[model samples]
Target: MPVFSCADAIGGGTEPNGSEVVAVRVGQHDGYDRLVIEFNGPIPAYSVTGRSGTSFTTSPKGQTVTLGGTNGVLIVMHSIVNWTSYLGPYAFEPNFPVLREARQIENFEGYQQWALGIQGSPCLRVTTLTSPSRLVVDMAATR
Candidate 1:
């Protein structure tokens, strides 16, 4: 393992007013970094993409955020928002080997954006799960 591992990228069109991001969690897997987002409503639609260095995630309302990282990844959920009403806390940077940080950038108009900073060439896989509607992101430790 190169310190990170991933299978494939995941992308889907997300709709507004579906769910909200309640919390973020990260754990070290066998060969990948696991990042999960807890949801309070239905599982939202989302898109994921890899980035280089600092990048921006602009909302529909012209809101943009510059996230930090060398080969960062972005996950934009259309059906969720980082609402204050949710009773969960977020861990911005767990300082994992592959996943350096998870930065919650913006929460506006039912849209939520998060950044996953990587140290090397990023390998990633995105997923959705039940039992409380969660979004999962996995990054590879090696090629």
Candidate 2:
């Protein structure tokens, strides 16, 4: 229910360089939480590694969900060039049950900000010029 949009930031054309926005959604499924990521544009070849280091390859564009630990989720967008470089590595920790409550806060305002780091080549920025993309993280309430 809670929707976080990164388009407002990059869509405004503030960053002349290419930019890629990842929108994340979190929800509860059975006993574990599920994360649904929607890629707005072309994404480079990458994988989602669990906190334990288990990695899974992802397609260039589409949506996918995986179940695992509650250490939160990390989205690593690599091989990014131009404007897309602005979108560095981003992570999210979504609250269960209240998931719908968070989506109400669009424009990424009032939401907890996660730390993002560049994987390699600090000088080289991940850049992209196209529609806004997204990465959603849904947290399940602990019973």
Candidate 3:
């Protein structure tokens, strides 16, 4: 198993060109609230950083995005292709114990951006899985 931390997690697959994001899902686990980003191809280069503000603005457009909780985390991925293939909602409010909401704020050019609203400060464990080719972000649930 990979280690978890409150610091930023950076790194992803070696898909030289680009990949399509097929699905995004959220679930509650025993010790963490999980957010899964499923891709049609290899996972793209990405970085997960905890944002300082609760409110965030969209890229390029500069429009404000509203999230449900007090803290936020920004996920930026490179070499993301075919945004039209992602049929899931661009925004959702799951309201889990730690992860409160999420929104795909940007999908322009070859870049994709997502914002997550969370409660408290949870440690993050980012893992890349095969067979399905997805990125799993696990936020530790507070007691």
lDDT leader: 3
Candidate 1 lDDT at 47 equals 70
Candidate 3 segments exceeding 4 Å error: none
Looking at candidate 3, the ten consecutive residues that score lowest on lDDT are 10-19
TM-score, cand. 2: 0.32
Scanning candidate 1 in windows of ten residues, the lowest lDDT window is 1-10
Q: Write the per-residue lDDT of candidate 2 for residues 5-35, one digit (tens) a residue.
A: 2221111222222324455454567533444
lDDT of 1 by residue, 95-141 (tens): 67788777766566666777777777667776777788787888877
TM-score of each: 0.76, 0.32, 0.92
Model 3, residue 105: displacement in angstroms?
A: 0.6
User: Which stretches of model 1 miss by more than 4 angstroms?
Assistant: 1-17, 57-69, 87-91
Q: Which should have the higher TM-score, number 2 or number 3?
A: 3
Clashing pairs in 1: 2-141, 3-141, 4-140, 4-141, 4-142, 5-140, 5-141, 6-140
- The candidate, 2 or 3, that scores higher on lDDT is 3
Instruction: Give the alpha carbon lDDT tens digit for every residue of 1-143 in model 3.
Output: 88778899889865645679888988999988988998878889999998665688898799997788878888889888776667767887899988999999888877888899998785789999987899899888863
